[model samples]
Target: MTTQKIAVLGPGSWGTALSQVLNDNGHEIRLWGHMQAQIDEINNNHTNSHYFKDIVLDEKIEATTDLKEALDGVDAVLFVVPTKVTRLVAKQVAETLDHKVVVMHASKGLEPETHERLSTILEEEIPADLRSEIVVVSGPSHAEETIVRDLTLITAASKDEETAKYVQGLFSNHYFRLYTNKDIIGVETAGALKNIIAVGAGALHGLGYGDNAKAAIIARGLAEITRLGVKMGANPLTYSGLSGVGDLIVTGTSIHSRNWRAGDALGRGEKLEDIEANMGMVIEGISTTKVAYELAQELNVYMPITQAIYSVIYEGKDIKEAILSTMTGQLKTEDEF
Candidate 1:
């Protein structure tokens, strides 16, 4: 309701798109990216050609390379960096902070090194005295469509309801709607794990499998996701919510998903290195598959789809053979978790 200055740390497609939403909400924005060229481009030309090829940005969205400058006098911070660099960016923000500010991240993927959620890493990185509420923004939304003002709905989840509600207000608009959720664990877990299934979906599509196969992959993927999510202290019902099934549907079905595109290239017989090299963006599901597979094993949860995808991505297994093996394996009675 009030005009505020918000700092968005990251200039990638998602971060850039989210900045546009905040700008549209009558908020002053400080958009930060490490690349000098991109920052200059956004500030001068009002465009990010690398990420959003044809999209023009708002001239009011100030671009910066300095984290301290971005966070200075800002009301809130939105982190939208890669999973690999989440902590690195958070630590920079922590060091720059001299006042309490609301923090939320849209990054979806576990830390491969610690298998920790992005919020967990944020908690460890940011000093409690300097940070206000921590929230996670996620759902079945893509940056490509979001920037174009297409109808989009997402969730702002936190351990504290007020925190979630605050974030819901932070970005809500006619074209961009947000729902508040309390289960940060479920929301975050579902957000990260769905990419693994999406990769599998894209692989199935690339391998010439029809709708039935993709549908089966999604259904079983949700089950596997819920199994692991519950074991990780998440509510089973949250898997049925927007951050879960909703997110999965979009990422698995859309061509805009880098994870799905990477999997498709894999199914097309491209080497993992080659696929990654050419994609030009982080294929989150590729790293998430490793994290989910390891987490499933450590938690003793059954996740055949995750395992098969993991094998194809990490263990040099043929994607087609792995899918075939999963299809022909002995069946077990399914239970709704």
Candidate 2:
């Protein structure tokens, strides 16, 4: 493979680990972070204390706070910032990189209120000529596990098969595996929407439910995802791939998931303000819940789990009440519509 200059625009755990993986594979990586402390640590100390602590960064992995420095001379860019800041960061970076650079984003969430997917948001912020070059990297891998070089898998989806293959080659390593998927819409949607269901699963676990309930919810929750995804131009089978069921399993079951942890706190009767303050990490499920609820409303899609979680989080409803309301509302055959 040709050596390429790769720029990653986030300094969080996932971003740092992914940058490290690319650096390990002999690619030149330019990592961008908003915090001076993170930039200083990466450049001066070869470490990111705030994210991947104790993991020594490769010399090929250069860190920068300046957007231009990160974008300059980069053949491709990874937009790994949080969902809320995706558009803002994309707009700033677009100003420096030309339209030919392949822009890939790992952030997974629909735009709240607008209900637009992250790819749509990226396209809106960047020039129209570069829209088709956008790519999304998603799957079940957690950043913490990835930093340790554990075996991991993810999907690279793009409008062009060649672009997807290129990103796959760039990211695949000894412990990191990449699969190519052409259904970008379904992959992105499943990746975003699964977080909402994960919140529900965590809330159920917090309420003392066992594995049986969690398994049932995950199954039904995926049905909801598949229904909406197909309606939005995604292939139904894509949701069965790494970006779909794979992501849902990890996010819903792992304690490392910010959304699941946040939902657990909420289930225990904690306020959003207090929970967020204590966690200090982006609970993407919060933002995704807003977008998922809005999309459900606009599309008239029946997302009971998403609706229940949204009620508890944004509508000030009691978690127990929401759970009961869903459970006791109706009963039907297992496969009945």
Candidate 3:
């Protein structure tokens, strides 16, 4: 494969890990972040100690603070920034972009204000003339494990088949695998909504609930995700793919998940502000829970699990009370969706 100069926006854990993957594929990586100290670390020491304490990055992956420098004639741009700032970053990219390039984002959350998916935000902020169809890279992968070169598998989804395959080729390697999917709607929805379930799973664990409870949350949470996804025009079968149940499983069960960790703190009676402050990273699920709850209400979909989590996070409801109300609600069939 021909080498490409790819711009990776965001120097967070996931962004850094993805840069390492691209570097491993023999591609030149321009990792862009806002912090000067982190950029200096990546450039001078070949490490981002703030995110990856013991890990060392490849020397070929250059770090930058200038948006224009990062986007300068790159073949593709991968966005890994937090969902809250995706639009802001996209606008900056649009201003700096002078040529058409493949655009992809690994962010998983809906816009709290617009309740739109990250790709929609990117499409709105970045003009069509400057980029190809937006591609979403998502699945059951975590940066902590991926940074260590652990075997990881994820999906590359786009309405344009060629765009998805192009991204699949760009990131795939011996330890990292990519599957192409045409259902961008399902892939993105599943990727965002699963974070809410992971918070619920973590809450259950923190409340001393056993494996059975977590399993129930995972299974029922997936049903909730599919119900809303289908309501929003996503293919039902896509929920069974890597971006669906696969992502839900990993995020809900893993200790590496920030959403899960945040929920754990909440379950232990910690304040939301405290949890956010201590985590030092954006827990995508916290905001995603609110957006998913609003979306479900607007779409008139049945999502009791999402509702319960939403109550605990947003409505200041007691965790135990929320779970109790959810459990005692009207009986329904297992295959309601």
| Estimated TM-score for each candidate | 0.98, 0.96, 0.99
lDDT of 2 at 171: 93
As a whole number from 0 to 100, the lDDT of residue 335 in candidate 1 is 93
Question: 151, model 2: CA deviation in Å?
Answer: 0.5
- For model 2, residues 1-337, the per-residue Cα lDDT tens digits are 8889988999888899999889888899999988888788888888877666578877667888889888887888898888888888878866776656888999888877678888888888888665446789999989989988999999999888999999999999889999998888998999999998888888888888889989988898898888788878999889888999999999998898988888777877788999999987888888888887888788888778888988988899989999888788778666543
Worst 10 residues of 3 by lDDT: 49-58
| lDDT comparison, 1 vs 3, better candidate | 3
Instruction: Give the Cα error of residue 102 in candidate 1, in Å.
Output: 0.3
CA lDDT of every candidate = 0.92, 0.86, 0.93
**True-vs-predicted CA distance for residue 270, candidate 3, Å:** 1.5
lDDT for each residue of candidate 3 in 158-184, tens digit (9 for 90 to 100): 999999999999999999999999889
207-319: candidate 1 lDDT, tens digit per residue: 88899998999999999999999999999888998899999999999899998898888888888899989999998999999999999889889899999998887898988
- Clash pairs for candidate 2: none
TM-score of 3: 0.99
The C-alpha RMSD in Å for every predicted model, in order, reads 1.0, 1.5, 0.8
Q: RMSD of candidate 2 to the true fold?
A: 1.5
